[model samples]
Target chain A: MTTLPPPSPRKLGLVIDLDTCVGCHACAVACKEWNDGGQFGPLPDRDAYGAEPDGVWFNRVHSYAVEPGSDHAEGASNRCAGPDPESPAPKPGLTVHFPRSCLHCEAPGCVTVCPTGASYKRAEDGIVLVDEDKCIGCQLCAWACPYGAREISVRKGTMQKCTLCVDRIYNETLDEEDRQPACVKACPTRARHFGDLGDAESAVSRLVAERDGYALMPEFGYRPVNRYLPPRPRRDAANAPPAPPREETLDREKLPGVLRWLDRVLSR
Target chain B: MRPTFSILCFTVLSGIGYGAWFLQGLAWAIGPICEAHSAASGVPWELCPVAFWTKAGSMLALLFVSTGLLCSLGHLGKPSRAWRALSQWRSSWLSREGVFALLTFVPFVLIAAQEVALWIAVVRAGPDGTVALSGWVSQGGLPRRLLGFCLAAGSLATVFCTANIYASLKPIRAWNDRHVVPAYLSIGLYGGCLLLAAMTVDRSMEFRDHRILLTGTIVLAVACAWLKHRYWRSIDAQSSTTTGHAIGLESLGTVRPLEAPHTEENYLTHEMGFVLARKHSTKLRRIALAAAFLIPALLAVLTFVLPRVYPLTVWLALASGIVGLFVERWLFFAEAKHAVMAFYGR
Candidate 1:
């Protein structure tokens, strides 16, 4: 049962837009709250109010400062310092908030490494899942995953991870609009979109094509279903022409004699 | 990558157990070739009237194996459900290891059971009386040879499965390497030779007289030391994946974590974020090589020069080898950097 299922033609996954994301952790919180009370209930926190509050979460938001001149850089960091007249200038890196979770790959190492056959990928939808009953909690699946998606539940002595909200996505009780992953539904900016990525005609698929979305660490060869739309090029770097020479350039003649001398010395 | 005590004990103890079994199997299969005079006892090894040494050696090997298997259960979160692990041998290396570990017991128990009967017959015949060889449990017989082959093949295969469990994991570059399997085998055999040498000090045995065992132990010790040294060098030279790759944004400018997902340690950080200082790891590596391989090997060589103190030196070698292996195992886990750490901007 640890063997991967045949490729699923209908890959149900997410496509996240980095340009639109605001680094808010609402998706992460919603995922935790829904899962804690849903089918995978009791995502326990060991010390909720104590010094070391440890708990399991299906999603986590990481904020990174992407510097300019890198292969993917659009321009200098968004927070780079303005022209400074005094001290040495500092390059403030651009912030890119990344929400990390399971990618639900077509060939996931996590599913195959499980000794207990607890981890498996669905042939119908390509969604990877764990059967808690069969899991001996050796944590080998966690080690096999490059994405750090699996979390060991110390209290239950079992592995926990993003299920893509299986229970809600197909629930008849929920309204049609609400029938989606908790994280996707909770995104305030609509940064996360969910659909059958396997179908090119699907809105999510077209969105991916238009945005030039990409899979994470494709070199790992998991063939992840989920895609990420890289942040769009910044306005200044995208279409703006070179700025006209500043007409009001500083004039040394109008400066005091001491100031003009200081400027000359500094420039030298 | 955290070096849990249970896992270290399982790997090290089982490696020694299997190593001893391999050597014992060879001796059993060779039949007449192992007929060297035990320096401690005046009788020849193969023609010895009493089967006490053979019986004790087999049982000791079994004991080490059983202890190691038991320790491995501690690594599972749900130990009660550990039986489920053996069901996936078709796909999982860990599962194959479990199945083989259990299957190995068959040959060991069978050999031990027959040896017990042989020992009883020799005891009842009295020290001066000669016990008939008969067809059963006869030295160099077909059945004995077959069992010996089974034991040797089974032991090596189980160790191979164990090594593959680590080597097959692609995310942990340190474990997923060409050197891991060879290093494991060499270390296991080295530990095994030390165990055999120490077994000679048993009260029933009189001398440290097995030349092959002593020489094999020294050779394996040197081999293991060199293999581990190479392993350390390779891992040290390896470059890890960057934060850019982890976030699937390598083409973007350099990625630096501005904020961690959590304020306190999470499971991923606690499990995979283990980082040993360069200075500390280097020191530990030296300690492991010196104490585990170099010193033990030197001690084994010294036993050959001072046959007067063979027992003392062999025992000392085994003791030092065990201590050094523990340190090495600790380093093996502690120094490994998991690929997931890239997301943490580590």
Candidate 2:
């Protein structure tokens, strides 16, 4: 009987700070650039300039206007709401920008459903990957996933997903500073972080403790490796600004000719 | 999920094949008799309507079923490695399916051989259309009986295998229930009835048996419709496991994401997080009905009403029914909501 190798203990993960995020898509672009050039083949784009545009990206950011009453904004007060003393008004709505990617769950459903054993979690870091040579393009694993993490590469007829920049993270050639994921390195606001989540004393672990981090769709029980810090609430309603006037009432007529010309140029 | 054509064809084609085979077997077992007379009176003994129609129907059904089974194997990346699938009988339903499907081939080939041999013998015997076989012969009476048993057993086993494949998925709430077994079996029954009707029309057989088959089809169709409706409704009522309360603080009665997890779409978003509006689902349901049940039922009725116009009606019904069943199967997979969907914040 063949004895299976014991699973490795390394648990790589991401820690995201909701408080500092500016919602810039630099991380997404950086990820695309890195993953597209790495060991995995190029991610092809279909009808990029057409009416229906679709392509592969390792990271995607979503903007949500969360109300104070919503569950996602439960602990956090609305930043849009004006700070007022003794006012019974509910917290004003705030636009929360969230970035989403594969959680690299502990219990990955995508790995198990593969009929050909093409999809498997790495014993070293628990990173899920598809062995393209062994994959028949059946896409059963895509159906089995709850996170919608897997996408069928139309060109390759094989499933593709976020690799967490696997080649870069483990490369011995790269310096320690350059070893992090492309997304983490490119994050403008330092919102995205990468480290070993399994280590309690790790920076990601400390951030998780201090910030009350949350997991996306924890109900899936996949136990994603990524952690998201709840958005920090803006204190004091007195510091808030009033709503902007309607567009029709704006004083467009008072603008000078040069300013109007500049405005038109900027608008275009 | 990314739709795999191989699997789609397998389910639809196999469904048609099994239906035809089962009905054909039933017809063979129960000789045709007049409903009004309660006897075989006035029925042409030489024609043997049920036997003739069932045999013809099953032949046609086998063509599609065999092709479908073969095509599904193409989905594997390493086709040669497919033999390994049979090794995991205890844990994997997919492995079990492969074994049963492979086993089915033997019986199907034997039955076809037996039927062809019998036909050739009949032709060689001339005008009497009679051929006698001695028990002592190796590939004669005993072999034929063994082949028949294999065919029947294999067909039933295939159906069971297909059902178990879906039923085994514990995470898919809609597929995991007890209803899956009966629903799959009924689909087979409905398919058999359609094939039986086609064969009867082709052979210009008696109208009475066609009527019984049509009635059976309608009953099965209605039962399927009810079961599907109930399954959808039940799923809708169930609360998601990932409730706002589960996360700790419950100030908000309902928790919805204020911001998505990412700016760029990831693997999870493309997979389990698919959302189709209720309106579109209803529209698709109507289309499925028109394709799968309504048109076929009407055709079956028309075939009974105008026996001389049987050919057009039978062919049209079969074509429409096959297409309809395909759409139905597609929806079966598409509409099924997994418990894991709750994790995607669906």
In candidate 1, what are the lDDT values of residues B268-329, reduced to their tens digit?
99998988634499789999989998998888788777777768888899899999999998
Q: Top model by DockQ, which number?
A: 1
TM-score of chain B of 1: 0.93
> What TM-score, over all chains together, does every model reach?
0.90, 0.72
> What TM-score does prediction 1 earn?
0.90
lDDT of 2 by residue, B1-346 (tens): 3235677788878877876766554443333333232244554333334446556777887887888778777775455556655654544466667777778678667667666666666678787556564442213245545655666666777777787777766556667777777777777768767776766644453456767876776676677667666766775665555523332223324444555544444444454444563336777777877877888777767766777776778777778878887777776666666554443356
* Global fold similarity of model 2 (TM-score): 0.72
For model 2, the stretches where C-alpha displacement exceeds 4 angstroms are A1-9, A47-53, A70-93, A198-203, A232-268, B1-10, B22-51, B66-99, B120-181, B201-215, B235-277, B280-291, B294-320, B323-327, B330-346
DockQ of each: 0.61, 0.13
Prediction 1 global C-alpha lDDT: 0.84
What tens-digit string does per-residue lDDT give for candidate 1 at A162-202?
Answer: 99999999899999999999999999999999999999999
Which regions of candidate 1 deviate over 4 angstroms? A70-90, A237-239, A242-268, B35-52, B127-129, B202-209, B277-279
Worst lDDT 10-window in candidate 1 chain B: B201-210
Task: Quote the true-contact fraction of every model.
Answer: 0.87, 0.23
Q: Model 2 clash tally?
A: 27
Q: What's the DockQ of model 1?
A: 0.61
